[model samples]
Target: MRISAVRTADRFLPERLSRQLNPWLLRLDQMLDGSTEHAVAQRVSLIAFLVRIISAAIALVSQVIFARWMGQFEYGIFVLVWVTVVILGNLSCLGFQTTVIRFVPEYLERQQLDHLRGILFTSKAFALGLTTCIALIGAGGVYFFREAIESYYVVPFLIGFICLPMIALGDTLDGTARSRSWVLVALTPTYIIRPVLTLVVMSIAHAAGFAPTATAAVTSAIIATYTTTLFQLLVVNHRFQAVVVPGTKTIRFGEWFAVSLPIFLVEGFFFLLTNADVLMVGRYMEPDKVATYFATVKLLALVHFVYFSVKAGAAQRYSELMHTHDHAQLSQFARDTARWTFWPSLMMAIVLLLLGKPLLYLFGAQFTDGYPLLFVLVVGVVARASVGPAESLLNMAGKQKICAMVYAVTLIVNICLSIVLIPVYGLAGAACATAFSMVFEAVTLALTVYNRLNITMFVFAGRTNARPVKEEI
Candidate 1:
């Protein structure tokens, strides 16, 4: 009883379309439930990718308004202040936020809800206290040595302090949310709502004929940071109540600190390596030059962010795979994750580079002057993506000490190169320094992944008679 096919002028259209989409469909299938571990990683990574694109767009628009409203000098100050707050705020998480994404997922997978409850409260309390202390101490030290830092950064630096606690608080909420796969809850407030709020507030200020300086911009940032984080806190709390008991047993504070300390070092060093060039540029060059250099880095960051988003998604999977003790499955998951990181990243890099000049031009004519730096920065990004988030492999594999060492060495090299080159080659020096340091980081992460995990962390994924990476429980 075969049914007759209905014929039309477009009879084979569905078949043609499916044929065209089959590869993507197969890839999607591979990404989903190729194994439970891989599926989790792929889904989180995909969501992070989509969210970051939205975030990047919102951030780009905000910066454009910031640049126009503040003028070059004032805009440069805001960049410096904003970057400072971001680094410190992320740092102030004390590694607990990201650590939660790691340990909570693993503990929960092991049905260690008791431990998960402990981590939940412990990480938040510790991050809150630590960052608050750091901000206060930093402010005190700055007050004492007020004559030390450059004149322009003083006010901006102080203003940046209001954000550190808020940022750190937001990060903890993000980690908790992501561990549970509440992607929107984890990302939206910080990435989307915060920027939108910042821009809206600043626009209102400018509309009222305010000076619209860095101070004004920073006031807006402070408002946005607190507003979004508080909102996230309330929403996350509501969700938390449904899943976790209010009176769950808490882990020992000492135990929590012990686990987070190494992670703290790893994160601190990583932050230093990533932001060293920008910090150094601000130190050596004028504020306006910093604005240009930061703009260039942001332009090239589209590719870099892909590698990061993949890392964020895959790190948890790496941890879960380690728990399985199945070498074959672990290697397959590793290879699949790496492959996911590479080809898509390469395509995205191509697209970003093509549009980079125009985006830089969005900052204005003087802003487009740094377009040449994009090529220099892109090399590092492509090279790193070539290895497919190798750093995550090391971090999740209990090689945080080695990771710290590698970042330390790279940061020093970056600083020395930036200092030497900037005086001679200007912004090109900073770009060159950043590229070289990133290449160094990729090489270090590749070796760590290879020696520790025995997987080839590279663009090329097939067999090479690779040996298994050894580690202790």
Candidate 2:
């Protein structure tokens, strides 16, 4: 009997050890199988967080390779031009990217298939047409103003413009996938595939005798953008076909435009605000300095992506909850998201800062100069995370105008601060400017959410009153 009991204990020991060792797997299984709306949102956020973590690693590695290959000056030029192009590409979508997130869920919930088909088609067509026009005009502007522009930037700018239409299309498709909670499909193309492809293509170009210059880098970007966007377009279309029944397409251009325009302002200012420091640094400093600053930013990407992941997962849920008039539940979920964002962000920021110098050194020994900037920049990232995705919640609740106003004001402050600070204090000044602006943004957003939705969204806030919304969202 004693021998038999010992055998039984031995058999159960591994099972007990597995449960203790991999509790997260058990939680993941629960998240996967749970039927509640919160469960789905949680699952999406977890998946997105994991995806962003992987993408951040890929991006960091690719960037290190690029810096090693092109050196700091060329890499800096590529970074500035590419960042500018990405901001414009998102703007060229004219708010349709988020507009779809707002409307698609509503349409699906209402079983409005015609409207769904109309929006899906309209968002894509509008993004392509509008961005194409922007690209052409931008190209002409660049040519006409060529003499006035810095010579090194001119060709890269032109090459980068080629990516505009495709970038906008990719963003729209990302939103399309996000609206349906297809988190992996929404994020992978932009975050994972595009960066990897750009690296591979750039390496190929260099191997084929193309110069290791910004022009070659931008050219690789063009090819990768086109390929990734087209691939995403096809995949998104397939997903839609499987779920959405075929029917006559409705065209509500006027209505969609009305919605998209304000969102465009909100998002446009938001992107500009987000990238303003980088742009300002480029304006006031040399390429090597820009490279160092950008490298620091890249190191911080792990912390920053936590907020983005939560924002991506929470927006559509916010839209559904708002429309349902589940104010109490919405308030609770908002607080939950704030927690989700802040804790992980705070944790990652600690880890990143602890390893900051070593990580920056990976970019190159010269790049290690960026280590000091991480301390200032991380404060802003964590501050922003404290409010979760307040803008997304507002926008989804149809409070875009107010949100746009808040962002516009915040952007103005960021630009003014960057301009005033970068020339005087250099990179440290830019870091301070960005960090201060983020704090301002967070406080303002928290106030706006409380005023508009009667929900407290701060990370440390207690249970909200859940009062009735003062007006239509």
Candidate 3:
């Protein structure tokens, strides 16, 4: 009887051990899954996108309040100045951020630590030096036009001039963090925290006996940008060091520029393409008219953000897949990404369209006059959605030059259309031009991806083509 009892006890012991160990094994699986680079990028991008949406909501309120307080004329000046800054700031980004996203991941994958470190350092330096020079040139141009420019606009533009360096630096840091899949760390500073803090500061300033004007708002933005970027740099640097030691590899300035210049042109042309409509309106129409158009564009931007969010997540994965020549998986991932970007963006467009009138009302009754423009603008957003984040897939797969060429052509087409249409149709014509140009850009980018990678970046009929590639991922 004792021997029999011992045998039963022995058998039960193994089962007890497995029950104890299974949870730990499950935890290990999760950890391993989380460690994949694609997983990290997707997680970070989604988190960043969510945070960005919240931050953008707060900013929208502030923009409306700020615009109302400043009155239509002052508000128009502010928008013009702000748009100019945005255009220049993006151009000055010089594709370092874009270049970093591509090269950093590839280098890290190949274990080229030196090139990795060099690229990061070089990219940041390139952005700073180039943007600073550009700002100085712009300031010089402003100085030349000071007599022709408004007295109020002069000071605000000058204040905005100071913002360029930090903005450029922040963009470079953002790219670096993204490459490493540090989404919150990369985006929180520039996108979420900075805009929120700017609003807070502006509100306090208004209450504390300071005149509520574009100057105060612009000043608040500058302070917020500097503070958030500095903090981001410190935290990102610490995390950056934790992952990989700096200076373990040599810096290659030459190679970095060779890649960044074409990319810079790509980004620059795209920026020009986007801002051309607003710019032409500003040139030909009254400030009040420009304000109406600008308001509509900002409202539609929310839908566009969804597209960008998916691209943020998909880009790194696309790069990694391209490196492995995993055509089958790449095709599948691109299709899924397209579906994800499109459906959400379409839903967002619908919701925003329904709420468009009220949201425009936030800018004041006069501002709400632009509601029809929302419908025109939304068509572009949804049309772009049909194709997904085509530019990202191209830019990631070392096809940025082709993307740039496409954007350049589109920009030229947009300008020509806007010039002819704006005079004839006014705001409606401007809206039409923008929508037409955007749809063109989307179609061109989608074709570019297909031509370069042979993957369909659309939602329909993707499953039938999911056959395995000859090469492994």
Best by TM-score: 2
Model 3 C-alpha lDDT per residue in residues 210-319, reported as the tens digit of each score? 98777887888888988988888889778878767856657776776777777787788877877888888887787778777888788876887777777777777888
Every model's TM-score? 0.92, 0.94, 0.89
Candidate 1 — worst ten consecutive residues by lDDT sum?
1-10
Scored by lDDT, model 1 comes in at: 0.79
- Model 1 / residue 415 / CA error / Å: 1.0
lDDT (CA) for every model shown? 0.79, 0.91, 0.79
lDDT of 1 by residue, 1-473 (tens): 32212222125558777667666665566555444556777887888888888888888888877876676788888888788888888888877876787787777767777887888887777778878988898777777787987777778778778678888989899988877767779888987899999999999988999988888898999998999999999998899788766766658768666666667778888887888888888888888888888887776656766776777687777777767666667677677767777787788878877898889888877888888898888888777777786666666677777777777888889999998998999999989999998888878877777777777777776754545667534
lDDT of 2 at 30: 54
Sort by TM-score, best first: 2, 1, 3
Is 1 or 2 the stronger prediction by TM-score? 2
Candidate 2, residues 58-106: lDDT per residue as tens digits? 9999999999888999999999999999999999998999999999988
| Residue 52 error, candidate 2, Å | 0.4
Runs in model 1 deviating more than 4 A are 1-35, 464-468
